[model samples]
Target: MTQHPMPDGRRPANQGPRAAARNRAALVAAARAIYAEHGLDAPLSAIARRAGVGQGVLYRHFPDRAAVATAVLEENVRQIEQAAAAPDADLASVLGVLTWHLTESAAFIGFLHADGEYRRSGALARGLALAERVKGALRGHLPAGHRLATADDLMLAVSMVSGAASGLTRAERERRVLAAWRLLGVEVGPLRPFDG
Candidate 1:
């Protein structure tokens, strides 16, 4: 096969989409682990080393720390979408999944809360769009006479759960989340225990 050299002279351009995807996944996973352990300020070089990729590969996939962080958050949104689309998923189950995710992903959540970079990079807007998708997916599951009319209402419920459960245990957070659901007039059935 004829080789097309990259401008950086480190790797060939014919690495294939699969290899590129693998590298991107590795970088995102490494960023998640390192950010969880050392916070978002962890060096890009450290992330590249952990992913077993060169700095150039990591840079090619994610131009900066905020891009990496955004990718991580985007993955989270995709997962939430999957959960919402599950056959047996209802409003309660979807909310439970989101609660569990937020509970286990405290570091990422903290980064979203503290870093203005996400807003500047448009990640926050993308996240809000995903949130709207979740809300739309759950709308059909709302109980009769319940009033979750808009995505903003759903977002308010999420804020309540996240804010109320701060510093609480996983179980406590689930309880608070369930309570928030009830308070929002969404009459969800009993929730499974949060596995996180």
Candidate 2:
């Protein structure tokens, strides 16, 4: 049997198990872009359209909005971990990666922060684990007697940084994160301009 295009000339989504990974990756990428631009309230149809897959493909991979949102966050953590794996990677450089993500991933941050129950999200746990490792590096870089963030301090800082980014323009996020961090006693030096 041939897999034929529909009357509109668009082929149906491939149903092979091999295609599942491709389709799932596509859905997560599309969801990330759509949510970044229009937020978590963006229509599921838009993510399907953006991924060039059907709505069924999207729903098959992700049972709900939060599930997809969790995947996006997981992907973000994976990227951070990859960056931190570099030989020359240090606390300041990794902090730069975090700053960049906090500015760009406001939708995911907002969704995860909406309720205490979301702490159960696997992404959140992976994130905390990553934060733990990053802290070891951060503390090594600190001068003698300098403060390191406690777990509670980090949790609060994330909330405040995401609060600074929420509903803010990109430039505003760049501005306000500095203010938020300053409140936590870290002075961010000059940063290179973020490309739009």
Candidate 3:
């Protein structure tokens, strides 16, 4: 078999910078899958294996499992923030974005709260910033001079709606979310079923 050289010229199949980034992204995605499967105790070696990279490459990309977890969380939050900031994003758009994001964010939040290591790493900071941006987008939808004063309030309302959806089935989640959006004054008639 032909030998693959590492970009650093030290290891075989040494991928270049772009390939390294792709590998790192694959590693992070693998980490997310492993965490979802094993509840955050998933092995780093397994992550490397899943990413098809050597242990040394995984280490070079992420110092440890904690780093991998943090990277995954940060990437998730960054995606949410970007979605929130997309052009022509109105109240309905923002609500849909956040609602979808929160559905997935619960997993990361569960992992973060359970692990002390992640708490000190500022992993949650990026999530908070994203949450604030989402809240601002929601607030912008409020009627002029309406009383949605703080991000906390918006977050709480979202949490309530999301949590309420948990008790019901998929169709119920959709129904309740639409009702909640209307209650929040979002004029979600066109966006009902939140199909958008």
Residue pairs with clashing backbones, model 2: none
TM-scores, all models, native as reference: 0.68, 0.69, 0.63
CA deviation > 4 Å runs, candidate 3: 1-14, 120-151, 158-196
All candidates' lDDT scores? Answer: 0.68, 0.66, 0.61
Query: Residue-wise lDDT of candidate 3 within 1-196, one digit each (tens)?
Result: 1136568776565447878888888888787666655556677888888888888888898876668876876666555455546676565565665555344333454553454666676656754665576566567665555545454676777666655443223455456666776677654323211222
Model 2, span 72-180: residue lDDT tens = 7667656656555657655555555666667666676656446553555554665566556545544444444444444445545656776887554767777787778
Winning candidate number (lDDT): 1
Q: Show how many residue pairs clash in every candidate, following the order shown.
A: 0, 0, 7
If the candidates were sorted by their TM-score against the true structure, best first, what order would they fall in?
2, 1, 3
The all-Cα superposition gives candidate 3 an RMSD in Å to the true structure of 6.0
Minimal lDDT window, size 10, model 3: 187-196
* Selected candidate, larger TM-score, 2 vs 3: 2
